[model samples]
Target: MTMVNLSFVLFLLCGVLINVQIARSDECITGSIRKLYEELNCIPEHDETNGCITSYNCSFTNDQRADKCYYQGREFSDGDRLEHNDFRSKCIPTCSCLVRDGRAEFNCAHYDCAEFFQPPLKKNCMRTYSHDSCCAVGVYCKKENEEETAATCEYGGKVYTEGATFFPNEEPCKKCICKPGFSGSLESPWCEEVFCEIEIHHAESIRDNCAPVYFGDNSCCPINFHCAHASSDETQETEVESTTITQKANDNTPTCKFGNSTVEIGRKVRGPEECTECSCKVPPLIECVVNSECQEGKLKTAN
Candidate 1:
């Protein structure tokens, strides 16, 4: 009830009110800065030294382009969106798909070949080496032996080897032919040895019917003549009926069959004249003067 007691109580009350006001002001400033950051896509920087004891904020301006980004009342030095072309865009012909629309734009520091080199949404018209970095065209692989001891011969993996396998099986069936003393050569006709062989069939048929190699990521690979790459994915479709690589011989010689056609291993046949039955004629002598080559021993002795 005394004056001094009342004055003391009043001072304490004033101090408490001031402290409450300062706390409310700090909270309001922090909430406001956070809201601003969200709206402007700016980073928030906390600095309590400059009257910002509770919380602080910062934003990027025209003066600083690369040093800062603001978010949630905090400033970050580095922040970015998804890298553009750095990711390879893989596209397919038969199915509907979704991908980023615009070209992925980014500095080399942020985007590189590993992440964006194989995006699934890139231009499909561009010639691609491989769909998912697996196979290449004209990949020659040597046929595996029956013993399964042979390594797979890849087409362009440093060493080049043409793959061949027998059509029916890995090796020819052994016939029950008993030989006396076995004096003949191991590969002779009487020896009944296993030989690598291939059936004479259309070779040109595959030239046009061969389908493009589909990559694992659903991109079409460029075709190369001898051994083009192919998709091993189960979802991918193959144009031919089980285009399997069977075992066959390595001979390129064309065989003449009694049927309507004859085929050589590598040569292309236009018609029946190239068959075995076709007669080969020796052209007339252009500079021959031998007496025996004439009608008689000495051209009838000059008649």
Candidate 2:
């Protein structure tokens, strides 16, 4: 080949090699940022913002002189206007990068080491109840950092983005059944609780008519009534007795049967037979009925 041709071919090869190297360098920087965040358990706080590093900011080796080595778009030029002139070299020693006097220092000793790290999503993996992954309400979610964090669940009526703080264990996961007179809506609806209990009130002679009012269990007491001394025949006994009423036309004595013996009710009869013969002994009556006619005067009392 001619010298000129050879030179042109070498130039083309050099261009291709430079492009590949740059690409590799960028990827390395990006990968390092990710690794550093992982080690520190750093989660991104914003949902829309991409991670701290991009391909343009990453590289295979920790170069102290590269402008945009740590963050995408943000570069540490040795002679940038104002501030620390040695911004690039300091970040080399540690992954912990510090900004001082307009200069950035990299220090990996401990960078956001307290954050909760989110595991990468697995291929075709389904999400299950993750009680351990939940955090408290009101968190600045990120992919890996706590303050700058993000989530991968649904919240605030919207689906959470990746790397957000997940409130898997929060009270919102399970809902409490609302008592009566309450309504549930879409944005904020009540959910059924694991176990719910209900209360009932009852008064003597008036059993509680308690039944399940809503999504809970109910109880009844003194609220219920046994058929008044229900007979083997399943009849409720009466509460009143027989009385004697003097008829305007005739003062004939009225009688009632009391335990196989006839006695006079209200007339104060001396003998059971006499009372029964006199039609004064009132018999036990069924409930909801007034047997005061057998008695002298009408006295009202409920069973």
Winner by lDDT: 2
Task: Give the range of the ten consecutive residues with the poorest summed lDDT in model 2.
Answer: 195-204
Model 1: per-residue lDDT, tens digit, 3-80?
A: 999999999999997787656544433111122122333333322333222222221232332333322233333324
RMSD of each: 37.5, 40.1
TM-score, cand. 2: 0.14
Q: State the C-alpha lDDT per candidate.
A: 0.25, 0.27
**Model 1: how far residue 303 lies from native, Å:** 99
TM-score of each: 0.13, 0.14
